[model samples]
Target: MLDLRLAPMAGVSNLPFRLVARECGAGLLTSEEVDARALVQGNAGTRAMLRHLPAERPLAMQLLGSEPEVLAEAARILEAEGADGVDLNMGCPVPKIVAKGHGAALMRDPLGAARALRAMRKAVGVPLTIKIRGGWDERTLNAVAIARLAEDEGVSAITVHPRTRSQQYTGRAPWEVIASVVDAVAIPVIGNGDVGSHADAAAMRTATGCAAVMIGRAALGRPWIFATDAPEREARAAIVRRHCDLIQGHLPERIALVQLKKHLAWYSTGLPGAALARPRLFQARNASEVKAVFWGLW
Candidate 1:
């Protein structure tokens, strides 16, 4: 009944990657959080990071900035470029963003983060959301406070990763805390933490009373996660073949070969010879060599 949202990992959630995840079972996929300042400068790499296949729809673009107005301007810039929706990344713990007083650093300044959310909501007519962590540390766990602010500002949704900033993606997320925030806010609450399986997806919804569950890390190389029926041998073969072909569809010959190798690991994970293939895949730098390894093994 609830949808599964894909967590945006930089260098990992590119357009080709999203397409693969979509085919697997992801209900909504977000692009890797883009740097607003870099995009404004017309950086080529930044531009490329924004690429999305036409099928990877209902895409949400996340912008990172600390200042309320600056973040608002960035949200407007993305909305005008035809983003289906926009998300503000208030939970990123990267020191670089924190150094600029952004990302999870916002947890230390809820008032400021709230004002930024208000400004961005005022600026955009599209669905606007906030992805937040519990707080800066155990001593400052204030996800409930942040959720309240998001609701007051009229945000379309709020996603809580449920770990303190100090926890930084380690340890289990505090699932019980999600109920407090859910009770406090009127918008959709996307619960994210250690959901790696469809069972986890169903459980997260029940555990937190969240409207949806979001997944990261677990999804790598495992599109079958969304459709887990212990795929048959023939189906497995077909999926691997199709995933490889999908990579080849969008990427150039050389790039596809190299990139598909990584995907091969994702597809092959937990399979009989998957561990043997990971190193071989990463070491592979071309398509023909990758095909040789895969086809030779297959």
Candidate 2:
């Protein structure tokens, strides 16, 4: 079977969403980005990102930060808490994140990224991985260079998004960048970006020789993308209900309400009048209200 994994999306790939994706056939789940400094400082919110049910096992937690020492300590905490692996985030293009010298900013300083990876690699016993962009920008397309550097530093695997930070999430993802990284690295390379269906996953592997495919934005509200075939409306409804149940059961009331509104809105994507109904979904004051608005549309 093709290895289809859920990309670690900030604020979206929470426990409930990951469970839904895994149930839909996603492999090797990853958690939302955890802040290395905040995690090491024992921030309650940062620690919450590490929470996982046993069923989500074999999961890796991705860390966001630029400091080697802070990241090393954070990786240690994740390993001690039972993470299957630790992933360094190097592809986030958010302006605030980049301004902090984290995320894709690290791509500009290969030596700094290597040092951080080296520190984290020695800090944890579990597999160490990284998700990187093609480069800092078009002028510096150095994914292959970074992949080779990661392999030399004992990184277990690499995921290439193949878009320069300058491109952010816009424009066509230059998959040839992925192919270049694959040809340049002996370690496994996972391809991400612009893959929305099983067909796209297969095409990525065929085009890039990637060992796996990570689905990001495309999986939003449509976890069934990981399933071998798209489920019927009745089945999709069941999945959506199950997802609602999971969110309610696993998260606090306040957070559950937000997630319920967010995901249920995504679930409403293709239904007639969905565009107009979206406002009501967000206006829902509680889970029951949210469900009422959504199922009314369903």
lDDT of each: 0.80, 0.94
Candidate 1 residue lDDT tens string, 162-190: 99888998898889888788999888898
Clashes of 1: 1
Question: lDDT, candidate 2, residue 280?
Answer: 87
Off by over 4 Å in 1: 228-230, 251-258, 295-298
Taking the tens digit of each residue's C-alpha lDDT, what string does model 2 give over 49-153? 888999998899999999999999999999988899999999999999999999999999999999999999889999999999999998999999999999999
Worst 10 residues of 1 by lDDT: 221-230
Q: What is candidate 1's TM-score against the reference?
A: 0.90
Model 2 residue 40 CA deviation in Å? 0.4
